[model samples]
Target: MSIWQDQHVTVVVSGGIASYKAIYLVRQLMKQGATVRVTMTAHATEFVTPLTFQTLTQQPVFSDEFTMQDPKHVGHVALADWTDLMIMVPATANLIAKVANGIADDAATTTILATTAPKYVVPAMNSHMYANPATQRNLAQLQTDGLQVLTPATGMLAEGYVGRGRMPEPDEIVDWLTQTLIDQQTDLPLHGKKVLVTAGGTREMIDPVRYISNRSSGKMGYAMATVARELGAEVTLISTPTALTQPAGVQYIEVLSAAELLTQVTAKFATTDMLVMAAAVSDYRPVKAVDQKIKKQPGQTGLTLELTETADILKQLAAQKTGQFVIGFAAETQHLLANAEKKLAEKKLDMLVANDVSQPGVGFNGDTNQVTLLTPNSTPVTTNLLSKTEIAHSVLTAAINRGA
Candidate 1:
């Protein structure tokens, strides 16, 4: 959702057994929200057909400079101009040598020469071929030319021996690309800051099996974490068990009970710039938890368990906060604003989000949410029913506007 989203990525495929790996690379890029298009050398078709890549990207593959399908625009030049980022995968020795010396004979090399966008070169071939003096000189020249190049893996080759010059695994390549893109984006709003987010309903166990929790599905917290990440913050998501898939590029920590959640959040709070406490912490827990499951009495009509107050995580953490911007959530069935206002002032929170969970399509295990935003000495602002993602954006935008 950061650099890869809506990006115009051009993949240049050259000849090698590693050409097949490019397929997975394209798929991964698309998964990261990129608009991908592929260009291939004529020889690359022998290994992977153009139709394969065509079907994968749902865009025409460019392999020949001579083919003029569009009357108004030259093929390679148009592709070059359309590209925001270019990748050369399985860059064979022939292509590398040509690119090093500025030879533009085919569609792939011609587009590479014409495009002003950043180029990433991934070389794969025989170990001896990669070790040749000419190849070494060309590789160095590529670095000197300001292109990002990945060192090939030292592993088993198609020739059935272990050595260098194997293309890196597809997933590894995608990870490298993702990190590189994030590093390059210095102007992102939360670029250098750390954000801590807690999600889900904390469980307070009474026995081995029975526990106290809530209807919180962690959807709101997950959305907050994901949106914070998309805003370019180094996000840490501390969550209770849920069915949600963890967002990419964010650090994750797991906790089951309120005590564990408190420990993790407090441990990371010192370095955090902003904290969003979205998890529904249990108000009371069993006073004594037995190791084994509690059994029902033979003649008993009901069961009674002693309960005690759980730790006040938000109030404790916020009371000691120095420069950190702390945000807390309150779910009330009645007197939403009055109750929320009391807590907001008592906890000394920079922002408080209050919602009435009794409404439909709003809060607790649902994809949609409606909330009232409160800041110290300011009027409360209410939001219409919206998807959790939209609510997340609104909340973060308000925080940023308030200089959080």
Candidate 2:
């Protein structure tokens, strides 16, 4: 069977010079056995006609909501329900902002806003426009909402400039979308296996207005999820609230505190094949959480607050392990290897990722990480600075090798 067999995809083309590429993407999806429906904005019609897309997709292109010719079939709601995956190729800045803000002024946006399916956005715009703070913020917000964002690459643009902002080629986009729809158990070394990945930093509430959290932004954990999906594992990510995009083919359970994390993890541990605890969970929380914001006293020299230890998530998970692969992360300053090895044995983890937070650009919120993969039986495998995506693939490979 094809990768996209029994799958339905909605390709939404926005207004841009890159709109023409959407047709090729549709054809590629069709080749992979996916049923595709096309939706285009008014300005998108300037470059390509509805007839052109209709002939390619073999489905009517939805342009306007009011143009529904039939009274019995609600077109917008029907299309929304039909879509299993939504990919917006050539997503312009205006379109990005609209989707980010939940604007549903047109057929494409309306269906997108209404659909409960996963959305993948491939942005294509001018280099400067792509890098604008407002656009970046919108992209981050979209990611935070669990939308998959494929970053624009650097290359020659239609505007005669060379930098980042070129839309990826149609075939590449198709491959990504195809991979996105494929079951995680197909052709993966870890096929028929279960994987648990934790990401972001938990927030420990002190008052209604304040909380304690670490510097972690959850990039590493998200990366691991992405890679694990690519390798054919059913992944469940326990994430703290963050702006990072959820990987395609992952089931995410969001938690705010260490206690919540413990509850979720323990509940899912029974059937899990491997557990990767990548979150920077808070070690302590305020003993008494103030229901209201704590008001500062005028004459107070310093505010004294009592704290209590949060649930030891990893240690507890380790105690109840049922021969499932367990992994942990050690973000340390001094005695890097020693600490990592200690954690590996003490927590009964199958492996631990040790990296010094003090090092520049190698820890939290950054794209690059230098990690040492510590195992119980052999020398640790250290890696140079690598993009989170690359590092994630390596880590998943290591885990699969070890587990197998």
Candidate 3:
């Protein structure tokens, strides 16, 4: 399930040109399955109407404490009580000052004051205003009051000046909020654990212009990295060439070849609590890479190149394993379980994820996969055809159950 499923999110929009952006943020939250209610400052309504937010959230937007739309209970207090998480997007300089000084003249401030739920403040203003001593002091005070404040992005502001104080993009805000919520769950299965994941297909250089690579799109590995982070593990993704975005809050290291992948994994193995080797490392590389691109002769009929074996990363990791739980992937076309089991035992892996690439929608370059989880002395658990994200959570759950 999505982390935001059934979550009650209260978005408090304050006055700023960035208030329009908050509409997009609210839309994203609802898309993630959050039941969102919006509270707008009177000035905020000038930027975006309450009717817009009310229509989008399918709930009444609270702007005044005296307004009695829900006659039975106080609107601000009721909303505050129902909120699981509260966020102030485009937290203007005035709102920050009011909040810091315990001022609650408006519905938004009143609800903020009433809620015991964790609060996240996203600041947005002119660069000079944000950098002012009073603003900085109030922000620091908010942190001291136990509120989480996201730093404003450094870029062009609404005033046509380029500097700090641009509100972060909607997607980035969602990612940050997601990570914050996940980190707050100390009881998550992988909490306090450090996970290292390798992703994408390694490229083996043959010449300046040519190389050997595989069809891996890195979707599965990227899913694993994202899920691991959501499970509260400190995740590091060592990746090869792929067109995927780096998962938020993950440490990303990009490498070019099997040799680089092996070196990076080896360096980090001892400190990691779990290792997921999902990358498709090239098994062979050209014996000697040409300094320049090999020219195609006009009359050439055939070309020959010598190849040599690349380092066996899994084997090397297995030999170096101390207390870390290691998981390996086997993408096979035949005898999938048998081959995966052999590798699991031979490489001392704690678990193995096996999938048949030949099957449609099962593996390699796809968003969906059907995988079998194999562990020492445990019955193989096969999952239904599911998205890579679902498969990632399943794999992590199995790993945790196996004492990873």
Residue 349's lDDT within candidate 1 is 97
Give me the runs in candidate 1 sitting further than 4 Å from their true place.
14-33, 43-60, 88-104, 121-176
Q: Per-residue lDDT tens digits of candidate 3, residues 229-334?
A: 9888999999997999989989999999999998999999999999999999999999999999899999999999999999989988877888999999999999
Per the 3 Å backbone cut-off, how many clashing residue pairs does candidate 2 have? Answer: 0
TM-score of 3: 0.94
Stronger candidate by TM-score (1 vs 3): 3
- Candidate 2: the clashing residue pairs are none
Off by over 4 Å in 3: 1-3
Which tens-of-lDDT digit does each residue in 133-224 have in candidate 1? 99999988998998899999999999999999999988778767776777687887778989999999999999999899999999999999
Clashes of each: 0, 0, 0
Clashing pairs in 1: none
233-307 per-residue lDDT for model 2 (tens digits): 788999999997666568999999999999999999999998888999999999999899999889888988899
Question: Which residue pairs come into collision in candidate 3?
Answer: none
Highest TM-score among the candidates is held by which one?
3
Better of 1 and 3 by lDDT: 3
lDDT of 2 at 381: 94
